[model samples]
Target chain A: MKRLREVFLSALMLENPLMRLMIGLCSALAISTRVESTLFMGMAATFVLVCSNTIISLSRKVIPDEVRIPVFIVVIASFVTIVDLVMRAYFPPIYARLGVWIPLIVVNCIILGRAEAFASKNDVLASVADGLGMGGGYTIVLLIMGTFRELVGTGKIVMFERTLVSLGSTFQPPTIVVLFPGAFFTFGFLMAILNKLENRWWGK
Target chain B: MMEAARTYLLLFFGAAIVYNILLIRFIGLCPFFGVSKSIETSIGMSVAVLFVMTVATSACWLLWGLVLQPLGVGEFLYIPSFILVIAALVQFEEMFIRKVSPPLYKAMGIYLPLITTNCAVLAVAVESVKPGFLKLNIPYHYSLPEAVVYAIGVACGFAVAIVMFAAIRERIELAPIAKSLRGAPIGFITAGLMSLAFMGFAGLFKL
Candidate 1:
């Protein structure tokens, strides 16, 4: 139990896939313009990561070393396909919004990186814990960026066509916050903050 | 003839500049940051991407039109099949290059495997077959010629962005900077500024 907790916590903070490891940023930046879309994207990615990590952990011994990358890709791709079809069927609007990013998840380094670095070497339970932790870390960063971007870009937060938080008409939004560069700026500042916190706490 | 040439040019620039695969569209950013630390490696990555993207996109285009679409499994099968195609193509290209031309392989060999997981290659492959995702001003479905042109343009755009960013990053390395934002954070901020510059090209040519 203690070991699993360590694995999980490390992924969440010490070795975040986005902030520290820097493995997956393509989809994170592209879809983080809106809180709703970021939430869904994070969920879809976490689902794929957990499932793929478990399967890869289970079959780690059987997969030959020479062909492991291909095998890992095949496993990850299958799960991404499952997520894609289900989303397209149930949520057409999101499916349309996410567009190519859904399929692009197949190549996301977070899943494959976890598979190669952690899952293949660890037990199933540990792998699952790591997946959740990494996914949570990725999602948290996405949410932070999403909320900031949406609020400042549009001056409010709307989910399901309802306004959740409105700064009112007096608050003029900076439209750039919702654009492509805003993604970089948000991620950069947030990453810097995380680094500052880590340094302050650990003295490293 | 002139009209067709103009259309092709529009598709090319539309993918390359206005919607750059790296700085603008946010695809294949892993390499954009990973390999852009040095101009040499970034150039190597650029060549590998250019070669593989065009070939991979063409191959996937053929597979979609020839097999998947005919069988009506394209809707669901595309994700898996396209990924497998890319993975296999990268391996095969690596071997083919080694056996056929040693010197050529030496230049691009290191980056070949890396391209498999690069989202830009896969994104280009999928977008070429399934249009409308990119929202380009071109037509709905891409013919072979158009797809090739677009892929080349995207690869070139990627090359331009990474190489340019690499040069900037090289200079950035020497600049005095905050310890926390020294590496990736500063990279992202610099990329953001560059992206802001690219945004200036949004409506150019009105393609």
Candidate 2:
């Protein structure tokens, strides 16, 4: 239980994936263009990561050394495909918005990198903790990015599918927030803010 | 055929310039972020990726268009087939480049192998396999050489972006910046800025 708390907490701030490791910025930058898509993408990635990490850790000892990477990849790829098909079927709107990013998860580097770096070496439970932590970290970053982009770019907080979490009815969302450059500028501001807080607290 | 060829060229160039599979489109970024620390290495890895992408695209195209598309398995076979083809092509390219281009092999180092996992190549494979994927003025019909050309052009565009950014970055290292944003922080900013600059060429060319 304590380990789980540590895992979630670490992923939240102490070892944030984007700001600290810089492992998976590709999807971070691209999918963060919209709030709904970012949340969907983040949750999907977290699901894949958690499952794959558990499976990899479980099979680590039995898997032969020669085919280890191949095994990990097959596991990861299967999950990605699973997510892709499921999204295409149920979340067609999101599936379309995500487009190549859905498939791009296979090469996310974070998933594969984690499978090899952590899962393959760690125990099942610890790997689960790590996966949960990392995925949580990833999701947190995405949510933050998504919230910023959505609020500033369009000036409306469209959450999930139907809910309009807009600040005020009169508020018109900044259209630039939905565009490409908005993703960057928003990310820059967030990064600056995160850095300032981190430095103030952590003394970086 | 000419129009079709031009379309592939358009996709190839489009993915490179406008969409930019690397910095902009967010594909093939592992290499872009990992190996692009130095200009010489970025050029080498870009060439390596360019070669592998061109070959892998054609190989997967044949596999999909001829084998999968006819059997109606084209839709579902993308991820599996692409992963297989890219992995195989990366291996074969690694061996071939090591043999024929020793100096090049030495420069790229391990990134040559990592290209198999690069999302950019995977993106090319996925896009090339899509039903009615358009290039420029022509309606894209999946063919052998066309796939290869499109892949090469896209990779070249990536090569253009990374190589250019890499050169700038190398020079920028000498420029004065605040202490907080020196290395990696500035690198990310630089990538963001370069991507912004690439936006200016949005409607420059049709293909």
Candidate 3:
């Protein structure tokens, strides 16, 4: 239990996929323009990551060394396709907004990286903890970014067509905050703050 | 004949400049920052992507058209099948290069395998077949050659953006930048500026 806790906690902060490792920034930046879509994308990615990590951990012993990468890709890609089709069938708007990004999750290094690094070496339960923690960390960062972008860019945060938060129409929202440059700007500042906090707390 | 040439030209410039895979579209950014520290590695990665993307896109196109379309399972199986094809293609290219061109394989190092996961390559593979995305003033499905050409254009676009960014970043390394902004923060800012510059070319291929 302690080991599981450690694994989960480490993924949340110490080994945060986006903030620390920077393995999965592409989708994080692209889909984060809207808070709702970001949440959906995060959940979809977490589901895939958790399922793939568990399966990979379970079958790690039986899988051949030569084709392990391909095996991991197959597992990850299948989950992503499931998410893609389900989203298309159920949540067409978010799926359309996400566009190619939903399918592109197959190449997301975080999933493959965890499968190769942690899952392949660890037990199934430990891998599950790691997957959940990492997925949670990813989702947290996405929500933070999405909040900033949605609030600043459009003066409000709307999820499922409902306004969760709004700064009023009189507030002049800078449209740039939701564009590509704004993503870079927001990511850089957040990363710097995270870096400073880590340094202060851990004394690098 | 003249119409085809114009379309190809428009496609090349459109992909390369207007919608650069790296800066503008935000695909293939992992290596864009990771391996783009030096011009040499940038060039090497660019070439590797160029070769792999062309072959992978063509193979994916053919697979989609011939196998997936016939089986009527293209919708469900595309992600896995395309990924498998890319992985297999990378493996084949690795073996072929090791046997046929040892030095080149040694030079490419890790970027070759990394191509399998580069979203830009996969994006090209998926987009080139989408009827709406690939309409190069042609109102139909992309032919094999057209798909291959567009892939080459996108790869070239990636190459151009990365090489340019590398050159700028090399200079940036010399400049006395601030503490926190030295590495990736500055890199992101620089890329943002470059992206803005690319936005200037957005109206180039306007129909």
State which candidate has the highest TM-score. 1
lDDT of 1 by residue, B101-175 (tens): 787677654456878999999998898888657657443788889889999999999999999999999999999
All candidates' chain B TM-scores are 0.91, 0.85, 0.91
TM-score of each prediction: 0.96, 0.90, 0.95
Tens-digit lDDT track of model 2 for A106-176 = 88878888898888997788778888788888888888888877776666776665557666768776676
Give lDDT: candidate 3, residue A103.
87
Ranking by TM-score: 1, 3, 2
Candidate 1 chain A minimal-lDDT segment of 10 residues: A14-23
Interface RMSD of each: 0.9, 2.4, 1.7
Give lDDT tens digits, candidate 1, residues A31-133: 9999999999999999999999999999999999999998998899899989988998999898888898999889999999899999999999999999999
Candidate 3 error regions (>4 Å): B99-104, B131-140
Residue A3 in candidate 3, Cα distance off native in Å: 1.2
Q: What is the lDDT of residue B51 in candidate 2?
A: 77
Task: Give stretches of model 1 more than 4 Å off.
Answer: B96-111, B137-139
Q: Score chain A of each prediction against the true chain A by TM-score and list the results.
A: 0.98, 0.89, 0.97
Report the Cα lDDT for residue A90, model 2.
97
lDDT (Cα, tens digit) per residue for candidate 2, span B43-99: 888777777788778878778877887998666667876887788778888899889
